[model samples]
Target: MPAWTDRALLCLLLAAPAGLFLGCSEGTGAEDVGIVCDPGEGQMCTCASGLGSVAWCRIDGTGFLPCECEAGDEGFGGETAGDGDGDGDGDTGDGDGDGDTGDGDGETGDGDTGDGDADTGDGDGDGDPILDQACYPGPNDDYSVCFPIVVPAPLPAGYDYPAPYQGNPNYRAPVRYLDLDAIDQSAQVAANFTLDEFAQSWKGRYAVLQPHAVAYVQDLRDVVGPISVNSGYRPPAYNAMVGGAGSSRHIYGDGFDLDPIEVPLATLEAACSNNAGFLVEYESHVHCDWRNVDVDVGFFGLPNGDAPNELPLLAASLEQDPHTGHWSAPASGFDEGEPVRRWTAFAADDRVLTQARGRTFEAPPETAYVEVLVGARMRLVGEPLSRRE
Candidate 1:
């Protein structure tokens, strides 16, 4: 009825959406005034002695309804439920009644069978839940039961000896040199073999075991019950001392001369033909290495249980963009809906330099190599890239 109320109603009519009313009022009392609003619109306001609450516009678009505070609001209308015992039973007191079970003993009130044990059902009488078998701590603190190969720092004395071994321009030493002193010889590197079994007996202090090579041996073990590692890593100097080939895979840390314990030598050699990149048959043992095989991006960090063919294939290749000089990893062989690319750059010393979530990466200065992992099942290591100036 007031002049200001008429103006308010006119404003609301202009602002209301299609099919919405413009004006509303209470009964014809002296204090009653016209209110303008859009139906179903909400606004925040003070209520219940200045507590925050929300008021919604009436369906008729006339006035704002009274503010209603939520049930949990302090000093508001609704009653706050008491903090019951967290036993998850439907009670709210110390006793096992049907009411709210406040923090009480581990009785029926707490959803326990009065056994004082929580509902974890671990069976150990402790309330803790049992972890998955896969989550149990392993010898290597990794998913695999095998221990990780340790590569010691500060190259040992006489590591690059015999001058010619290091003087050859084409000669490249093993990327990873195991520190026998730091390794647990008794620790399992596979199901049957120990780290000590792989150490170079000539030095007894340093060794190498390429993960893929180790994986190959494990695959052989799966086919045959168990195998023996007669020879594993051989340092360049040791290789020469033992009349090993100048380019022997042992110097690279991937070669192994294995003898099957349960199967015939011929059967073990046959298995190596399918699993190894190269194999040489001898009267006593069969020599195998992954030197000629393409990198198995998926097999590097995984547990050594599955055969090479059973593992996922991630045939990724690194290419440099001539225009931008950035490296991009394009890959295939992943299962449907399974591609999640991650790129990592490593320095010459095997230190991680940087990582990218995408397929393309801008190599940092002094980047030695790039690797790409697709999901958790596939991985590919790119060929060593030329160092950037």
Candidate 2:
């Protein structure tokens, strides 16, 4: 090697070591590097071991210090934690295990790590609102029963009867009526009552007051007798057998028949006036309900003219005709030759009374007699009438 080259190489090696030593030399030694970081200098330095990395420290306390450069791809950069120790237990679950916070129930899931307590006394089933475990809101209204009175808005035209009112529970009548007092049903439900005893006990005259007819009679009381119940839940087939095959509503639980007492249907209707939905008379009986129809049934004269409408059933006029259990309704407009009888017991006040029937199998033109039921209202109508339109 040339003499000049050797000297230059030796000088370069020595300088490189000197630079490294100075840069990495800041130590915790008290007297060591008084080199402090100075903001004015816009530069600072840190120790190689990162002894005081909080920031902006220096060697001589004020002059511009060299910048310490750490490796480029370092993962973490921060002050190492002190040796301080707290409770060693790393259990991080909430007090309770319900997965809920604060309202500790004591159940803890390491993965689901939460307090799992369920019964929180909150109406919502969750202890806390934010942590409410319940999904749906509770029912604010009734969840269990049909109210004592089932009412639909926009009442129907006539009375809406659910099933035959098992009648008021407290109601009872005479032996002639049913001997309710004799049978002592003031407190009982199904008395050992027979159809005959039920019949002989009829103060209301008609046998429709038979079986259940008697029970219905008790409902009328001194108000009147022969207060027959013509149609008390008859099946659809019976209405069909009786020529009601066309518009029979017996299929639905919402149908019933009304039998007039002594007056004419016109009088009963006139009494109702504009409120005529409840007093509609068909060939057989008065159709009293609350729902109105698009077409009035009066044209067929079921409520008035006999024109082959339905029947004109009479409570007092019932005979032991061979049709014992089943009796045919009389034609509209009684035959002039046929005897016309007057029922007084079922009549009272300025008002008249009548029986309730199912369907009538006659046409119109015949003047149907009057059958007025007392207490014009109060009858409860159940389900909708079958759409027999």
Candidate 3:
């Protein structure tokens, strides 16, 4: 499979009307030609009656074959003598033949509601609104039609995020990804999310609602006031493609990368410190995740243990472990008289060290300080976990 980042690629049940029935059209052989099945009172059934014509069974099972309604004869099914069933009544009648007029008039009395077109049910003879028509071939068919109620406009202000689509207005917009297929599979998106704002993707496309994570977000929102979501709920394939850890919490819908647009990075970090199960600082974003795992407060270069809040030396050297291929070093390279901060490396590329720890140690080779703060505390204070990378 192609990497997630390389391609970043790719990517209703309605109820039928009551008493309505549909049957498979039998072959056109004489023995197979049965009487048109009536759809019954207040119901209708349509079928292909001619090359380009339609047949309808109206109220009281009076079936009408397609008509041209021109200035000529009955043109359609208005056969004057019998229903072609050889009963000899020409019209659909009770066969009483006392000059009954074949109108079926009184049959519209108490049986029909308004204009006496019993088929209209609330009968103005208009039938139901075209959009309001219930499932045509019953709700289970592949082609059932329905007019769903759409709540539009301000209700869903953002086209990107899923928090709003999850049906809770209180949750902010820009949820990154919403799994709509998951909704169809379960017939409902998790109770917390709605189906509208969801977008399509390649695989494992769904959002999960972990209450603790939600609460942590709520807390951050409370302090920072509407943080924008940068990333959330990555499919495992996507996570890997994007250079995320194979076991990233995001794969499980438990992590969030938020944009500190309206608040200071320090403020956001402080908020995370107070609420998150795991808090990490990245180059351009802050990562927070909630899980029941026991871990300490991870402070990523946030000036822990007498460390200065100032930026580290830009050209500082780093050391890399040949065996594990990991890097570790202090935040600052200056000696005793200079402002120095220790580094506990989490993840490192040839140029940048990613995670933070309490004490200074050996840094990764071929790396330079990028001033990126990505700190992660595992199950205890000062001890950071590097698995997030």
Q: Which candidate number has the best lDDT?
A: 1
Report how far residue 128 has shifted in candidate 3, in Å: 41
TM-score of 1: 0.36
Candidate with more favorable, higher lDDT: 1 or 3: 1
The weakest ten consecutive residues by lDDT in model 2 span: 5-14
Task: Tell me the lDDT of candidate 3.
Answer: 0.34
Report the C-alpha lDDT of model 1 over 23-77, residue by residue, as the tens digit. Answer: 3333223243433444334444333354433333433343333333333321211
Using Cα atoms with residue i matched to residue i, what is each candidate's TM-score against the true structure?
0.36, 0.20, 0.31
lDDT, candidate 3, 245-285, per-residue tens: 53455554557777676778768878887874556655466
lDDT of 2 by residue, 65-168 (tens): 11222333111112321111112111111123232111233222222212333221111112121110101111211111111111123432222223211221
Q: Which ten residues in a row have the lowest lDDT in candidate 3?
A: 295-304
Give the least accurate 10-residue stretch of model 1, judged by summed lDDT: 127-136
Error of 1 at 263 (Å): 2.0
Off by over 4 Å in 2: 1-226, 245-247, 271-279, 293-389
Q: Best candidate, TM-score-wise?
A: 1
Ranking 1 against 2 by TM-score, winner: 1
- How high is the CA lDDT of each candidate model? 0.46, 0.24, 0.34
